[model samples]
Target: MIISVDHGNKSIKTPHLLFTSGLVESENQPGIKTDCIFWDGKYYSLTEKRISYLRDKTEDDRFFVLTLFAIAKELEYAGIKEPDDTVDVTLLIGLPPAHYGQLHARFEQYFLRKREVVDFEYNGRYYSIRIGKVVSYTQALAAAVTRFGELKKHASSYIIDIGGYTVDVLKLRYGKPDLAVVESFEQGVITLYNSIFSQCNSQYALHLEDCDIDEVIKGEPTILPGEVQILIRKMASQFLTEFCNFLGERSIDLKVSKCVFAGGGSLLLRQIIERSDKVGFPIFIEDIHANAVGYDLLYKSEVAAHGGQ
Candidate 1:
């Protein structure tokens, strides 16, 4: 079976499952645990016992646990008998454009052709699977390929991926990643939310969780009051203003290539970008799923191109 996993700083996204990128350390495993995994010198909780994971999870062994958990959850959802099944698996993941080259070999060494036992319970079901091969792609490029598919007519593109933690821009030339202009901006959607959360907590004494803030960002009425809503919008405006200033300082040549906006964070900034005449009508695709969808598509294409080699 082939699977793709994206360990975004704020969330873990796969073609099958999406969960908060949070892990908790827990001991006291006396009487048989239900949904925990022991891997690479750490005990991790698969379900509720989580603190937000913000660092480079891919560099450590937690990536495997997350992948196994995603596969197990997907199998449970698919009604497959998964306990003790040593299924062959091909794992695909992505990285930022700037780090893709330096980390490519490291990630490949860390994940490729690995056989490890993953025992976990997902959705009231038990599962065990042996991991097989692992592969990776550049995040922004994968998103662009996913957006354009095989029929992409453009020869070059500037992929502006506004993700949860970082906004990465990759310059693609002649249908390949041009690493020279790859840039990563610290401003992202989480920055906007974090600003709002901190402001609300300081001003209104409202301690809202990340999930609640996400709901509000999606235009849901969270009983958070119109006053808070106004305040958050103000914060968003300031964030946009600052982002615009950052863009101005960078002096990106928008005319050099077609701009494609992608990632979950893109949805919030799409209109702002459209309104500003700076970006030249940036194209927006399936923001949240573009990278994973692209990874899946790439996996299929690779398999077909290689004749399942």
Candidate 2:
């Protein structure tokens, strides 16, 4: 079985596939809530009804690690069974490039030390089990592989992952990430929303709620002052500018056979790139589960490489 967990700023997604008997099953999205709670040396996932409890408990505290726990809880909640005993499982997760240095080390320590299959209690019920080793969250690289498989011929490509909270631009030279050209930026949809909200409140007597912002992105054509649109354009422009600058600093040409966009925020940002005449080549956005599918490919490759059963 290969599982890929996509922990985004807005939601948590787990897509998994079981590989056995010489057949590959299509990945299924296991419906899972994104909230979790850690209490008394045991982790408990928060049901939709219990989400109110966490607000009072974890004010201003980091709950990023709970993202992984949320994935485990979801798997069990969906009744996805694992093999008996300790089965070798490879977990593929995605991490923000900037936090790779600090967060990666902490994740490794937390998962490797504790191998217990403790109950992920949620709403007074045991929801899931946390198993397997803490594997690398290399979904960005996996996304490249996923996109490459769809291309008819091999060519260099640039993958701009405009995720919920961050944007990662990576160069795929001959279908693999050129580590030297990879860069992460903090400007993402969440930050964009904050900027729009700030500008709206300052200029007009308007306070934008979360759903209102989403509604705008969903093609509602928000009735904002023209200045707000300019601010948004500027923010997006700066992000792409920094990405281009990073490529320039690395002496990497902007030439690519195709520029692929993957992530939840891609739909909103698609027009931003479409309007830019300087951005060469056709831009393509992969399906929402592109990373999950790519992670499945990587998981199978790793298992084959290691000679797993």
Candidate 3:
């Protein structure tokens, strides 16, 4: 079995592909809220009722710990088992690129040291085993796979992934990522939300909890002020412009084929790209779970290449 785990700022998404004998079965574990409680190097998830209690407590760092615990519990619930009887299981997790170099060792230690387990029944067999070992890779790996697959039909392409907290831009030359042309920006949908809330306090007083910005943007202007909408559009435009300029300086031809967009923030930012005339080629948006799905596919391919049982 190959599992691709994406731990996002807002939620954790895990998608798995089980390769048994000559067959492949795929399943997605629902996203879990990013809330947990940390105790003695172990984390536990808080129940919905516990969240309500924490809202009223306001204790120092209590919310942070509880949030971590909540996430850990959810991972346990997602069929991760303890290694009661030693079995070979390889797990690969995706991490933010920036953290790859800095937190690699620490992350490995945490996963290996942590005794958490995921419990589930498979093919009439019950198993309880700790993740044998957890491996971590940059989100770029997943992003690269997604871009390559989406642009494989084209000769060359550029990928722009506007995620929750960052925007990753890369150029693919013949289905392979040209790292020299890849760039990332901290400004994303969250930045837009903060900007809107900062500018129009009364008109756009809603918080992330009260509204789903992605859903609201899909329909007509219902909650956000027109002024805020304008700002968001401008921000999106600027991001794309910067990305294009970076590509141009690197001598990457935007006219090669098309530009592909993915990530949670892409839905809202697609309009800005579609309306822009300064861009040279057409823009396309991949599915919201593109990264997760791509990673799952990549993991499966890797196992097959190794001739795993």
Candidate 4:
């Protein structure tokens, strides 16, 4: 089976499942073993506390372990329960457009293991699977793959992926990326989170997490003080303004180009982004799993072109 994964700094996503990028490892299984996976004598569980940004995700096995979790979740979603046979899994993954050139090859090699088959346990069920080909694609543009027919009508379009740790911008002229203009900026939603946390701590003497601020932005009823919620909305708007300025400094005039927004941050700040005058009316890819879904689509096209490679 071909399974695609979009490993974001804030979350890990598959076509059927999405979870935090956070991982908790333990030598022994915990008493409350919800969402636990056991592999190589170690226990791993998903957590909301995401890891710090890493320039190279292949530097450690953390991401690899997370990939295993993703695969297990995909299998579970497909109703492939504790089968006796070993399943071959061809994983389709992706990296930001800016990182594609330098890291794509390494990222593919990182998932290849010496052993032909591996066994792991998830939620008390065993899974035996072999890792086949690991394919990597560019991130920002991947989410826009399915809409190329529509995008081709435009002379120029921009895919602005507002992710957890980086805002990846890809300029596509006539539905294909202009490689020279593919860029990733460190100013992502995480920066806004940090800024909000700092300001809230100093002003209101209350520290806040992303979830707290998210509630405020979504206009969801919560226990937070109204003043704090107001501050969050205010800062979120300012963040969008600063983001527009950052893009402007790079000569990216969103006003002149058709823009498509993707990733979790874009969805969270949908209203705020729509309210910004810096951009023309933009199309937001509300599905957080768009990248993963795109990866699957791209992989299928590749396979068909190559005659079922």
Scored by TM-score, the top model is: 4
> Of models 3 and 4, which has the larger TM-score?
4
lDDT of each: 0.69, 0.55, 0.52, 0.89
**How does each model score on TM-score?**
0.82, 0.70, 0.64, 0.97
The candidate with the higher lDDT, 1 or 4, is: 4
lDDT of 4 by residue, 1-309 (tens): 889999999999999899999999999897885798899889998889998988799988899899999999899889898988999999999998888899998999888775378798988999999987888998988898967888888878899999999899998899888876899888788999999999999999997888998889988888999889889999999999888888889898887778999899999999988888988959988789989999999989988999986
**For residues 201-297, what per-residue lDDT tens digits would candidate 2 score against the true structure?**
8877688765565554444677765665565567666655665566567664454336777776776666666666536764565466666667667
Give a tens-digit lDDT track for model 3, residues 5-54. 55444334454321100111124321454332324434343332212111
List candidate 4 stretches off by more than 4 Å. Answer: none
Tens-digit lDDT string for candidate 1 (1-309): 777777676667776677766665455342455555554445566553233434355556666566667776656567676455566667788888777777776776666535665555443455566566777888877888875653266677778888787888887775567767787777777777778878999999998776666555567668778888778767766676677567657766553447788887777666556666556647887657678778888888888999988
Q: What is the lDDT of candidate 4?
A: 0.89
CA shift of 143, model 3, Å = 3.7
**Over 4 Å off in model 1, which ranges?**
28-55, 58-61, 112-114, 149-151, 173-176, 253-257, 274-278
Error of 2 at 293 (Å): 3.1
RMSD after CA superposition, every candidate: 3.7, 8.6, 9.4, 1.2
Cα misplacement distance, residue 225 of candidate 1 (Å) = 3.0
From the highest lDDT down, the ranking of the candidates is 4, 1, 2, 3
Counted clashes in each candidate structure: 0, 1, 22, 0
